[model samples]
Target: MNLYQNDDTTIQIDALNMLKLKKNILLKGPTGSGKTKLAETLRHELDRPMHSINCSVDLDAESLLGFKTIEIKGGESVITFVEGPVIQAMKQGHLLYIDEINMAKPETLPILNGVLDFRRTITNPFTGEVITADDNFAVIAAINVGYVGTLPMNEALKNRFVVIDMDYISGETLKNVIRTQTLLEDETLIEQLGKFNKDLITMAEQGQISEEASSIRALLDLCDLTTIMPVERAVKRAIVDKLEDDREQQAIINAMELTF
Candidate 1:
């Protein structure tokens, strides 16, 4: 749960400042780059309850707004309206977290135009209720650009927030993250794993491997597996086997061999 911050990086500070100014935040980063972690951190620091929505192509209006469900009351069936994350967060004046904002279908996102803008209001299509957000309601959205199945964010939608770019942790910061997150105690082994992660990241950047294989979350999983199994086996299960392509798997295996 820890996000290692280098001395030179003011990511958390800058993000807090933006939220304090009532500006929505758009976190742009590669997968597993701690965008969601950063959002959670800001929510905790601001002492606001957060309602999260994981965006994907399958996301729809019912998920964003609310749904109606039938229930029995006094032996009679009654239909009740359930508020979705967007409406709940607005009404409660809490933090609204939209993870992978660009993954939702393009046509579905226009529903948030008024909610994310200066108006801060959304008319519930299902209930025909015009809900105005509380003054303290804020938004924090994260995106992974250039990934498969992710759509380009509309510029009009993109212009509504302050954008922050998050990148992978490296060197001592990454080493510390591994040490803190895993049961690994040996400094030498931790350093080796850190180097291996950096190498995989390099390969991913060069298009030799997918970004998912180089993720810090995957690296953490590998480290945890090493506690119960051999590093080689851990690499195969945690990093290598996750990719279906033979060439990519072998590329990871080669890196593992070179590193170990």
Candidate 2:
């Protein structure tokens, strides 16, 4: 929360400034691009309660907007309409962060159409309430392109936001994050890891490896594992072993051999 910038570097500042003016934005980028973290940073800066939702392919309007739950207030059970994260954020004027929004069901996305536009109200079919969004209520959805199992968001939804393209940072900026996150000042190791990550990403782009095997998370996990085991074993466990496809696994292993 105490994070500050002397030069206002990193794409995070761009997102903050854009959201300040537009109120809604779509953060579309590759995986491990820090989209979710950027959202959390903005949420803290705004000093608002955050309702985070990890969207799934199975998510529907009924589940996301609100749903009925049975409650026993008396001798008899009564159905109660409980608000979901979307409605809760709307009513309380909080930040509604939908992570990997493209994973959300197509039918579910229509429920948010009205809320994202000038007609900022969502109709709750269960309660028959047309809930108008609060002034402070904002939606920031993030999506990773070309990730397996992810579908393209409908044009209607894309029209609702000013798209912000986020991607991996580089040079000293990346090294700073590595030092801060890993708590290690080994420049040589950091540089090597950065090159390794870039190589992995290049492999993914060239259809030789899965992006899942080359995420920032995977690198951080590998770094953490190095403290307890050999780097080779750590690499296999943290990244290569995650790939289910034999060809993908072999390509990643071959790259590791060439790089290390």
TM-score of each: 0.91, 0.87
- Each prediction's Cα RMSD? 2.2, 3.0
Most accurate candidate by lDDT: 1
Judged by TM-score, which candidate is best? 1
Superposed model 2: Cα runs more than 4 Å off: 1-10
lDDT by residue (79-171, candidate 2, tens digit) is 999899989998998989888988887767887888888888988988999899888888899998887888878889888888778676555
Q: Indicate the worst ten consecutive residues by lDDT in candidate 1.
A: 1-10
Candidate 1 lDDT, 153-256, residue by residue in tens: 88889999888888887888778777776788888889899899989999998999999998877988998999899999999999888898999999999999
Error of 2 at 47 (Å): 3.8
